[model samples]
Target: MVAPALILVILVTLWPVAQSFYNSLFDYRLTDPSRSERFTQSNIDLERYATEYFYISRDLEDLSAQAPDDETAQAVNDIQTEIEAFHSELIEMDGLEEQYGEVDEMIASFTAISDRDLKYAEVDNDWAEGYKDFLAASNEELIALSEGAPEEDFSTTAGNVAGTLDTINSAVIESNFIGLSNYSRYLQDARMWQSLLNTFIFTIASVAVELVLGLAIAILINRVFIGRGVVRASVLIPWAIPTAVAAMMWGFLYDGQTGIVAHYFEQFGLINDASVLLSTANGGMFSVIFADVWKTTPYMALLLLAGLQTIPGSLYEAAEVDGAGKWQQFWKVTLPLLKSAILVALLFRTLDAFRVFDLIYVLTGGGPANSTESISIYAYITLFSQQNFGAGSVLSVIVFLCVALISTLFIKFIGSDLFEGRSR
Candidate 1:
């Protein structure tokens, strides 16, 4: 019985974690042409760029026909020079494809690191240097393309040259990972620290605001009052609205030119102007956090309200009989009994808030100087925008660990009885 339970835990929880670790050991691309013969076949963007370059070249030719002076001639020449460089780069990229196609030497470098047979420098620099030489060959070809460079010829060639570019990208990643370098890099990395600090500040303030406001709303809704049913629904309106939709709603309201938030803050002298609110570092963070709190406060309230309802009325009545006033009864009887429920709610909401991405993503896009960048948004920018896979993987691990640590600590405070029914 224990064997089956242990196996289940390993499969469900441990395996994927182990796989992330496994992958972290190797520097590889998910879609490296070195791994596939179908790069040109699958890449729609390659063909699209090729077409775009063709059109751009033609547009330049047409513009050149209308040049009125030496200055105009020089400007056209500058633009064409850049375009021609692109053309040459594409042609040379084909040889890069052929070179790294199942590059055993580079693979040996990565494999040696995986097996602990090579030092950091050997795997990172030496192998990367090997890749760079091939890439240089690709760059040289790009240098050779003339004004008569054929666009059709490049569709096939870009896929080839792209292989070397891919290798260079991989090398940049391996350099980030191999030693205590990333830690040093992380320390020196202003953007990373700023984002990390902002995330912490947002997490703390948002969690605090949600809990205080949520408890007040939950207590109010729990009582017998007029329009109780209608009031409950009204209170939940914010929660019922999807986060993305709410974020967008707030985005419009906070829009620089025609936004209500910007207008109000400006009218009341709370902000200097609409652009200032969204563009200033402190104001941007404040706006993002406020928007998140507005959208999600009701969610926290609903959780607390559920816990409040489960507290038996009898306890409060007994407290009243014992000469406890409403406040005292709330403090001694209701609060004590509802501690478990509150803990459960807080645990869920805190974890969710720590991973906040969408609201910040929509409302601010981690900008006006990245003051509102949550870890989730940071991970996204790394993975998708920067396309730095190694750093992104490291960030994913960090996010998971932070959330897990928070949950563990919170659960410990509430005690194991809360989870007694659930087995590992």
Candidate 2:
């Protein structure tokens, strides 16, 4: 039974992480055709190559006939012969001729080759390198001939042929597999480190403030008071609001000229200027942290309240009988008994805070030179905005490792005391 459940857990949790780790091993990017997919071996984009090769052959034939001098004509014929030989060799490979014919038919009919198996054909690494080098040399020669051509038509045709060669060369996709290189590259990236530092600062500052305020709120509301249920319900309103909506609301509140909150903050001497809150790096960081604390503190309070209610009234009474004051009773009785609760609350909040995205994303958008940018935001920009899947996956794997490390530390240190108490 345990084995089956454990297997399910591993499948559900680790599969996506495993996929990301695999992608991080390659130089994958959706924006570039050559790097759109992970290639473990050199491959040819038959669709593109076959389509362009048709035009290239005709263009080179025309150029060779129209060459101004014997030397230019001979150079063009040599380039044409070399390219034709490469194409013949490519089509002669087993299983490629049939696909090449089908791609040729598709091109003739103006149909896109949508099938991957029919589109890309793997080739020997050495052949791919040789073909690419030859294409480069031919292009350079054609470019020189075009520049020095006596007639405008000759120059234009030569330049167009050279451009066609470049297009064909791009169709020859090389293997993008570079194991652990993305990780090493990002490890030395200053922006990555800065984003990480910003994440840590936001997590530490918000969680610390939330813990303190939450504890105080929990203690205050735990005592018998007027309309306690209403108070508790009201306190949860901030947490109950959707985070995006709350962030938008705060954005309005933090606006320099029109926001009441910023106006009040400036009036209270908290800031030198109202516009500083969103215009400066430190202010952007503070703005997000402050918004996060306001949004999450109620949740922390609610968790602590559950723990507070679990403590018996007898403990407090006993402390009082022993001549203990309120603060002493709290330290001696309340705090000691609330250890497990505090641990649970802190662990949950810390992990959540560390991976914070939506709140900060909507609040600051990681702007003001990315002072408020978290690891998640950086990963988002890399993965979606820039469309660099490999580098983005590297950042994601780093976040997972950091979260794992945090969990280990919390369980090893804070949880040890709770487990020991239970054993005792």
Candidate 3:
């Protein structure tokens, strides 16, 4: 039973990490048609290439006719002849003439090509490289011809011809498999480092405050009280609210002018002024940390409360009988008994605080100079906003590694004995 369960766990947990790591190896993006797919071999986007080729051939014939001098007309005709030769070679390779003709007709009729088999076809790697080199050289030659053309009106046509060659050049999809380049570039990026630093600072500050406040609340509620249930329920209101909603509420409270919370803080000199809280770098970081502490402290208290409940009441009574004061009883009995719970709470909160996105995203949008940007927010912007999948996956893999490291540290230093004792 455990073996099957373990296999399922591995599948669910590690599969996405594996997939992300694989994607990080490629230069994948949605905007670039040639690089949209991860190609393992040299290939051509035949539909796009054929369409471009058809236009280039027609334009070249018109350019040859429009030339001002015999020398210029012969030069234009030479380029046309070379393009025809290349086209013949391309279509004849592995009998692609039928597919090429079909794609050409599709373009002529202004029909959208939907068939994958007709769109992408594998080509010899050497042939593809040579063709790309020729296209680049041809573009340069066309630019020179346009600049030196005796007729200014004909220069525009030559420039158009060069531009069309560029489109055809881009249609040849090369392999986007650039293993580890994205990671290497990001490792040296200062923005990446700064985002990581901001994340660590936020995580440590919020988790530390939450731990202390949570422990205190747990102790307070553990005693006999007249309305314990009501107090307990009230304590959880902040934590129970949806994180985005809480963030929005905090945003209003942090507003510079009319916000009650910011006004009071300004009066107390806790900040330089009311507006600075959400507008300045240090103030922004402080506002996010304070908001996070307020929202998540109750969750920490709940976790610690469970641990507090499990401490046998008889032990505290025994400590009291031995002349131990309430403070001493807590120090000697409660603290020792709650070690495992504290460790577990820290592990969960630290992980949650590290991956924080929605709270900070809604609150600050990592704005005012990206001073409060977390790694996850940075990843979100990179992956979705910028549409740079290769770079985005690098940030994602880094976040995963950081989470795994935090988990490992907690288990090794604090959770080892707890698990060992349970096993025994």
The per-model lDDT (C-alpha) reads 0.64, 0.91, 0.89
Write one digit per residue (lDDT tens) for candidate 2, span 1-424.
Answer: 6899999989988988999999999999999878999998999998889889888878998998889999898999998899889988888888888888998999999998889988899988888999999999889989999998889999999999999999999999889999999999999999999999998999899999999999998998888777987877888899898989999999999999998889999999999999999999999998999999999999999999999999999988888899999999889988988888888788989999999999889988999888889999999999999999999999999999999999898897575765665676
Model 3 clash pairs?
none
The clash numbers for all candidates, in the given order, read 6, 0, 0
Where's the lowest-lDDT run of ten residues in candidate 3?
415-424
- Give the winner by lDDT: 2
What TM-score do all the candidates reach, one by one?
0.63, 0.90, 0.88
* Model 1 stretches astray by more than 4 angstroms: 1-16, 26-180, 421-424
Ten-residue region with minimum lDDT total, candidate 2? 415-424
Error in Å for residue 125 of model 1: 13
Per-residue alpha-carbon lDDT of candidate 1 for residues 334-410, written as tens digits (9 for 90 to 100): 78877887888878878888888888898888887777888789878876776555456566666777888998899
Candidate 1 achieves a global lDDT of: 0.64
Q: Can you give the lDDT of residue 50 in candidate 1?
A: 32
Candidate 2 segments whose C-alpha is farther than 4 A from its true place: 1-13, 414-424
Could you give the candidate ranking by TM-score, starting with the highest?
Answer: 2, 3, 1
